[model samples]
Target: MTAQNEVTFRLTRCRRSVPRTRALAHAVLGEWGMSQDVLEVAELVLSELVTNALRVPVPSDRQVGVRIARPLEDGLLRLEVSDAGAGRPEVRAPGDEETGGRGLLLVEALAHRWGVEERAGGIGKTVWVELKAPDIVPEPVGREIAAAMVRPGYRLRARGEWRVVVSVRSEQCDAGYSAVVLGLDEGPALRVQAVEPLVVRQCEDVMSAAIQLEIAP
Candidate 1:
């Protein structure tokens, strides 16, 4: 089933937090099966937001909060950065002589929509942006797992029809066998057991596989 997945980070106010936030965002969004294009844009957005938050002139001990979420139903990726310091972030027009101050401008250009919100209790504000997310892709099926070329986001023939792979899982069974569970684009879940030691290797951006797997009667 498709659901909203989110992760938040509390970072110390410092220059190092900028790169650290980018790395954390890459790992989280990568694990969520985001495409490379999405990953790149999200990392850039996170960098700008986190950098802006760190620049807020709050107390040294106060921390900056960063949140990354993908709401499957909305088909958009949401990014938020909250700072204990006051003032809303504004997009600026930088002249040719200006060396900086164009972060929010880049954000405004790339983000589908963005705005600021007052934090709870009115102690600070949260800057949030949303980007259009790619459609959800289903997981690899049983035959694909057995072939060891499990590619997510690729279509495969199953039950006499083509379906995308949304999620994939493999578990070692007793003896020399493994069990694989795949969630398809539709509501059906594919379960298979392979006796010949399975080695699942992931390949990104591959074409649809013509291999067919039959569902149990």
Candidate 2:
């Protein structure tokens, strides 16, 4: 089996990008059929990671990198946020009157494990977290069918809203596709592709559910 199912995003260093990254992660994880419990925890963890990354004292032109992945062999979801700044994040208990400095505390409490590492061949560091993913069985689908279903015009419903597939990319290392989708009402969303076999299957399952809903009376 492939090592993991993963997606990466690069966002400008701005306040608005926090929620945008969170929403994108939520959509991709939903397509993977993560349990509601896992989703809620993952979202909160991701938000803190991204928010902390933005607070790093990096150059204005530097972009923040976010990666979300799940190992194929285990029940864990991993999130990484990389920035071009050079300090390790410390988790300290916050005072009752303090209005800030609680991000890492929240991360430590919610994640099974998390740490900071030097960014591979990069200028700064990556802060990462792992969370237990329970009760998620990757749906199975043929490669041909998955490729056909994730094309640019494809539509799927997620989180009670319709989203249209805006783009698709073929993975270089494996027979998987990554797609970018936008909510019908929300403009310019992020990628929703699956790079591992298990994730491809789950993407197909999402499409199947959408098709069923579309045809229902």
Tell me the TM-score of each prediction against the true structure. 0.62, 0.63
Residue pairs in candidate 1 whose N, alpha carbon or C atoms collide under 3 angstroms: 137-166, 138-165, 138-166, 139-165, 139-166, 139-167
RMSD of each: 10.4, 12.4
**Model 2 TM-score, 2 decimals:** 0.63
Q: What is the lDDT of residue 51 in candidate 1?
A: 89
Poorest 10 consecutive residues by lDDT, candidate 1 = 194-203
- Each candidate's lDDT (Cα)? 0.74, 0.70
Q: What would the per-residue lDDT of candidate 1 be over residues 1-217, giving only the tens digit for each residue?
A: 2212677879998899999998888887777778899889989998999988888888999999999887646678899999998878888998999998999999999999999999987899999999888653333333333522444555555665556777766666565566666777896877666333332322453326534433222
Give the CA lDDT, 0 to 100, for residue 174 in model 1: 61
Cα lDDT for residue 196, candidate 2: 20
